[model samples]
Target: MIDVVAAILKQGDKILIARRKEGKSLGGYWEFPGGKIEEGESPEKSLIRELKEEMMIDIKVTEPFGENIHDYGDKKIRLIAFWGEIDSGEIVLKDHDCIEWVFPKDLHQYNFSPADVSFVEQLMK
Candidate 1:
């Protein structure tokens, strides 16, 4: 399975979510901002690297939310979500189409990746 890490970054009552760019896998779907866990890197360490590379922001992981595994026919991944806060840097979108900071209660408004559905449900509970 493809191993990935996602960040559950919160600012006030809203959390950060990013949209996948067109032409990419799961393109046009929303997901927590993060990327794959590289070799020799822990999940949290991978998250810190991904957030910076993708969003140009620094984060300190506060807690691990949980994990989910899902398959989209051609591709499958195990995503680990974590709770974190911005440590530094400006918000820049190096990847993804755009971003939204939304209250979790309203997460239904956007189309999220299938792998993230469980994480969203757990957040609601």
Candidate 2:
């Protein structure tokens, strides 16, 4: 299984969501900004590194909201989703095609990776 971490970052009533770049895996899908967890690294550390690499922002990871295991055709992904807050830096689309701060009700408008769909459901609840 591929271990990954995702940041559930919110600013008031809106949550941050990033659009994956075309030609990438799950291209055009929207997801919480995060990346693979390296060996010997904790989920929090992975989240911090991923946010910085993908979003160009630093964040402080809080408690995990939930975890989900999803299987795509080629691989299985084990996602550890955590709630986090921005510590510093600007929001730049370093890896994603675009970024949006969307309200929970509007989340369904975008296409999301199957694994990430569960996280969004948790956010709504």
Candidate 3:
């Protein structure tokens, strides 16, 4: 299984989510900002790197939102989620088609990937 880290980046009462670009896996779906964990890197390091690479933002990955393993038919992934806030830099999207700051209660409106949908439920609690 692939290990991935996602950031539940909070700014006030809102959290950041990105729309996957067309042609990518789970394309057109909204999900938390993060990517696969590379070899020899911790989840925090991977998330910090991914945010910089994908969103051009620096973040201090704080507390865990929790973890889940999901089967996506062809592949299964162990998703490690952390909720944090932006530490520095403005967001400049390099990968996703769009980005939005959504309140946890309203997250259900967006079409999120299955794994991130679970994260949303946790946030609402």
lDDT of each: 0.91, 0.89, 0.92
**Backbone clashes in model 1, listed as residue pairs:** none
Identify the runs in model 2 with alpha carbons over 4 angstroms from their true place. Answer: none
lDDT tens digits, residues 19-54, model 1? 999888789999998999999999999999999999
* Each prediction's number of clashing residue pairs: 0, 0, 0
Q: What global local distance difference test value does model 3 have?
A: 0.92
Candidate 2 lDDT trough over 10 residues, lowest sum:
116-125
lDDT of 2 by residue, 1-125 (tens): 99999998988889899999888887899999899999999999999998988878899887888899998979999999998889999998866898899999889888888999988887777
Clash tally for model 1: 0
In model 3, which regions exceed 4 Å deviation?
none
Clashing pairs in 3: none
Q: Which ranking of candidates, highest lDDT first?
A: 3, 1, 2
The top-ranked prediction according to lDDT is 3
TM-score of each candidate? 0.95, 0.95, 0.96
> How does candidate 1 fare on TM-score?
0.95
